[model samples]
Target: MTNDPLSPQSNDSQKRLMVALALSFAATAAYTFFFAPKPQPPGAEGADAGVVLAQGADAGTAEVAVPPPGNGGTAESTLTAEAPPPPLRKVDVARQEAKYTFSSEGAGLTFAELQGRKMREQQTLTIREGFDKLFGKPVPTAPQMNLAHPVPGQPLPLSISIEGNTPLPATTRYAVEEGTTPKGAGTLSFTGRQGPWEVTKSFLWPHEGFELVYTVTVRNTSAQPQSGELRVHYSRAIDPEFEHAPSFFGGVGNLSRSACWIDDKLHKLSPGDKPPEDTRGQVSFFGIDQQYFLSALYPLDGPMAGHCVLTATPTAREVAAGFPLNVGPGQTATFRFGGYLGPKDPDLLRTVPGVALRDAAGLSTAAAFHPKLEDTVDFGIWAVICKMLLAVMKFFHGLVGNWGVAIILLTVLVKLVLLPLTYRSMVSMEQVKKLQPRLEEIKKKFADDRERQNLETMKLYQEAKVNPLGGCLPMLIQMPVWIALFTSLRNSFDIYGEPFFGPVWTDLTYKDPTYILPLALGVSMIITQKMQPQMMDAQQAKMMTWVLPVIFTFTLLQYPAGLSLYIFTNNVLSIAQQYGLRKWLARKGGNPTGDGTAAVSAAGGKRK
Candidate 1:
């Protein structure tokens, strides 16, 4: 309404409103896209993985069965002569819900499928125990988990389920598959009976960073050609709330809008394209306390036809498993699918028949290559330069056996390489500070006119040969380097458990719970900020002198300890460099007063 077209207060208010609207829209879109309604499948129905009790409930009753020697029996027998102890048993009861339990065949072997739960698909009849055969040799261990949430002091539940609508059989043991073929040793013993059709299966830990693979060969024992629907059902120990979370399956999976190595030259399937009639087999994914998405390549004509169904919600029941396949009389159709129940590992991903896994932690493969094309002006050239730096870091790490030290050495190397630019920046800053008195006089003469203040400042900058942004250039150059280092630390599995100088710091990719590094980082930052050139305003000074160090300290508390240590060391070194620069500046006729005089005002000749 007034003659003023650009009042400060009105402009600021308008900016705030625009920002709020933009944020609200972004949040709404994110919710609609990422958290939209996608119900769970029916096959996902189940209670928690129930607990299994030790042998017997009573004391001294002994939970396992002890067998006596068959022919040669005596107390003088060697201890090794005694067979390994039987596998531990776990069972739990769910109120008003179906019951499930799992047990193993023997020590270091997978649990067998006891009564209940059998799939209709033909599979090798190995005991449904938890185990893996590496190099064709049985691994005497259990499946390794990235993180364990076993309820302390409470029994762990064993999950059990059946698929393929296989009819329950009366009490009988069937040898559908054998591990050591021709009857050498290992075998799967499927004991079947009726009544809710429960089957107990055991599991063994997998090798570190690898997933446990359970493959069983089943003979279509039914005389009738049974074919209709196939079910793949499971129950886990996770809660219903986390059952549909992508993280429950494997966080940071390789999901892409395009493929890198696939045969994409030919007319490929679009996101909405459906294949030929013969190629449209159904894939139903169901899980309890587990979230999953599926992509499959079926033998179409010769090569393969791809079909996929992504799990959208935690409550969507029973995604249709397409139509059923016909099982010929006495003939078996081998169905191949796998479950990845661990963190995303590049090497282990090869075992899965699909795309690589990526984390939803914001960094995408395309984003990693963004600066090369999108930010051509600022980062395009720098990306190429950083590649050489990355090679150097890798080379140093290869020699030192520690990434933390390598980062420090790399930082030092960069500082050395850019010493000339930094020295110039420091010299310019010192000169600018020395001329603060003169600059303030100019500001006071033109205080009422904003345009004149900027012109006078520019004129002074020209005379002094000081580009006000010179200092910013060095900082700008360091950003790409810092980003590259961050990426390296984030993705390097070698640093997962690698020790740096001892237990004081282990696993450079995770936070140091003790807060030692974060505090040290805060202190170092404070020191460096104090030594740097004083800001042009009290607000700016307060931010650099107090607010930033406190914020970074609190921030570092939650970041990886390795990253904190790197930042802390960097700040300490910066403080030392700044101290040296200050001493030199003082000797070179620079102003002794640290309260940047250029920030003063002409009102009563006051210094601000």
Candidate 2:
């Protein structure tokens, strides 16, 4: 009889093919949904704004008046309403590490771009122009004093009213003054004044550092005493460009943190928490931080009496801190402040001077400081492991002078350290493979009884002195290290623009632009699996051989190149070790198979 093409058997085969195709598509969609880089929801991009907290009666003494709901008004709108834009004059300062641009209008910093950075497209760190702009209004360009409470019916402190009434100009055209400091460091000064008050803003740019010492001097020119709170603002809007990038993890978008060091501890406020009403004490530092950059304000001389107010919207985060200021008539009050606007490099942050300060009476004291400023790195629960990995990588880089080579070396070292466990696992797997024939016979003998088959399988494993789970234990043990390494490579700023080989692997902190590394990694994994001794049932082994490689390849496609490089190197090392171990065992004539005769002979030899 001739089989017909349209027979039920043919139809069944076609249906099976369609189902398989549908499953493949579903799996692809599932992978994309779980592992693909997802665009953040509106207002959710920069959520982990660093620790924001406040203490002290002065913290929330003056409440910012917000217009009632349905007014279509925001704090920015309410504050800037009817305010004229100040005529802005540009000021540029260039150093070896960074370039700074300032506008005379509010003496607000317009931009700070780091030099020698690989990804320079959006490297400018300053998100906004002025400190007062944090509050949604145009305050004087220079940092100035704000009244604790404005007089009833009077304009808010540091508002347009202050600029309109006081002889102090809302916008002063600061004369550019240059001088060489005693240390031969270059100094840039912008000096200006409003009615009866002379304000001079000076910056001491070192020949070799990212930290800039900024000093603001306010002189009471009038015959009466002037008392108010001095305020410095650090505000940044989330970078829209990095919102979709893989490096934009943790605190991307509206996830920013505003934190202050109070009473020797770091106080962080959540997004929904109200800004502390009164934060009073030795405030060592307060700033706004994003994923890769930090903009912080520090008191140069000592812990100043200060409090911070942190506010955020869907697109921006603003931190405003106030320091007590009292300038006697005809007396000048010069306050020194330090500003850090750069990458969140732990080493760089450590190099920042004035982390410790001297108090009055010449006693040295620890300031309100977070230890190491390392909190900015956000290494998560495995932070300790991550730091260790980074240290090792850095050490390797120092020796090899190439990040890609260093990563390979790091992988080798990790593998060597875990060699014993992996060796044992390989032996166990080989034993399981040797027992596969016997296991298949037992399965067939008890084909109708799954419980009896499992019992007999366990008894067989016991008799052979082989652990069925030994192979899995080593992998489980190494899981944390693998996870830590992945996190470290992904979040490391040092690797952001670091090149592995040449232009092709230009940025290890980002995904491979050419997809070569991930594909190679996937291929290496397949080879490693094939080389390893397998003990799975035929169907299980077949499924793993095909599915695992594809799944890993797609999953790793979105990971940073550095991570992919590590995995690829590790797989290669594992394959080499497995091959070497197998050859060594064969030469030794040890039974790699758990056959009953080999087991009996080994036991008898041991007894002899």
TM-score of each: 0.50, 0.67
Tens-digit lDDT track for model 2 on 1-608? 32787898888888999999999999999999898887666535232422223345434432222233345544344421111223446778777767677656545565666676442432212223222233354432211111011223322212111121234443444556778666566677776654456678777766666566667787765555667766665555544443332322321222456667765776655445574434667788777665555666677666777776666544445556677667776788887766666677787777565322222112234542323455667778999999898899999999988888888998888888888888778777877777777788889999999999999888778777888788777668667877897777656777666878753565576566456788998888888878877787878777677788888788777667788898888888888898999898777664544453477445334433
> In candidate 2, what residue range of length 10 has the lowest lDDT sum?
141-150
**Root-mean-square deviation of every model:** 30.2, 28.6
Give the alpha carbon lDDT tens digit for every residue of 68-100 in model 1: 334242223211121222334432311111222
CA lDDT of 246 in candidate 2? 30
The CA lDDT at 238 in model 1 is 25
Q: What's the TM for model 2? A: 0.67
Indicate the residue-level lDDT of 321 in model 1.
21
Evaluated at residue 61, the lDDT of candidate 1 is 28
The number of the candidate with the highest TM-score is 2
| Model 2 C-alpha RMSD to native | 28.6
